[model samples]
Target: MRVVSLVPSLTEAVAATAPGLLVGATAWCTHPAGLDAVRIGGTKNPDVPAITALAPDLVIANEEENREPDLTALRAAGIEVLVTEVRTLEQAFSELERVLVHACGLDRPRWLDEAGTAWWDLPAPPEASRAVVPIWRRPWMVLGRDTFAGDVLSRLGVENLYAGHADRYPRVPVDDLCAAAPDLVVLPDEPYVFTADDGPEAFPGLPSALVSGRHLTWYGPSLAEAPAVLGAALRAARP
Candidate 1:
């Protein structure tokens, strides 16, 4: 079965499960490292004509990363597009199964099973830390309500300060976030490339836990290591 994936995590999933099945992927689909596939484009701006030209049996996309009009065009072109909505860890697993097992008609990948075990075995700290997770710096966007990263952090006892905020990813003034006075500031390396010198300086005295964006936000084989990887980073946070 030939497949084209627009979402990076889904691209990694398809590639890891059956690399030969994936004939095309987005330019940002940079996982399973050296994936040999036709570059369709970015998640928000996939090349519809280029994708259509690939003539794959299936195309995978995410509700959050992809644009609706692109999906509509693919369907209009008679291509089978499987759209996944994964806002939580559990949802990620279910969606992975749906896309890989049901949509692609392939056996469940062993890595996914291992990921379930990884998350299930995590020991949630009784006293969770309040944290403001910043995804981007310019205009300062943060993880808000109904986000996959927030849900993952919640499981690991890192409470998101804006978890109840109206927007999923809210752009706030850096000053306003500092006023929230979170126990720590969780920073991921993607979408903004926040680093020791870059993001930590924004929150003067607050502890900053720099984390892998893939493990923090992505829902793929990385799930197998997210629990342990993110857990350690969150725990080691110092004020």
Candidate 2:
């Protein structure tokens, strides 16, 4: 079946489930390397004409990734749009399974359930008591309560320093970060690629680690591999 993916995360999911089935994708969908697919456009502004030209049997999008206007336009064109809103890790897994079911006509729940169980079985990472996870730079955005990345850090025994803050991706002041004085600071590699050099200068007194952004933040089938990978990374970084 011909499929078009407007969301980057869902593009990764589709490639994982049915690699060659993705006929079209957004320019940002670069997860599964070697996917020579058509770039229809971005999440917010998809090339409607290019997508229509592809004549895909299905188009996948995410509520957070694609704007309502874009979805409305696609729907108005009578395109079968599968919109998913993935917040928590469980929701991400569910969305991935749903995509697989729709794209490949496969029973994805069985495999997803098994993977979920395995993820739950892994031992919890050491609790750092207080921690801050930075997913973006420039303006400096952080994960807040109820977010999948926040939930993942919680599972690792790291309490979000800004969990009770009003915003999900709050712009924290450098002084505020210093005041929080977290035991650990997590620097994700995507959205913002923070290196060891970026750490010492920005956070002079904190112990920081550059982590795999996808493993810690991307809440899809990747979660199965994340718990172990993240747990090990955090453990190794501990003082």
Candidate with best lDDT: 1
What lDDT would candidate 1 get against the real structure?
0.91
Highest TM-score scorer: 1
lDDT per model vs. reference: 0.91, 0.78
lDDT digits (tens) for residues 19-38 of candidate 2: 77889999888788878799
When summed lDDT is taken over every stretch of 10 residues in candidate 2, the lowest stretch is 106-115
Model 2 segments more than 4 A misplaced: 102-104, 109-114
Candidate 2 Cα lDDT to native:
0.78
For candidate 1, the per-residue lDDT at 98 reads 97
Clashes of 1: 0
lDDT of 1 by residue, 1-239 (tens): 88999999999988889899999998998898889999988999999999999998999998889999999999999999999999988899999999999998899999999999998887656588899999997789999999898899888888899999999999999999999989999999998899999999999989999999999988999999988898888778844
Candidate 2: RMSD to truth: 2.0
Candidate 2: residue 188 Cα off by (Å): 0.2
Task: Give candidate 1 regions above 4 Å deviation.
Answer: none
Clashes of each: 0, 0
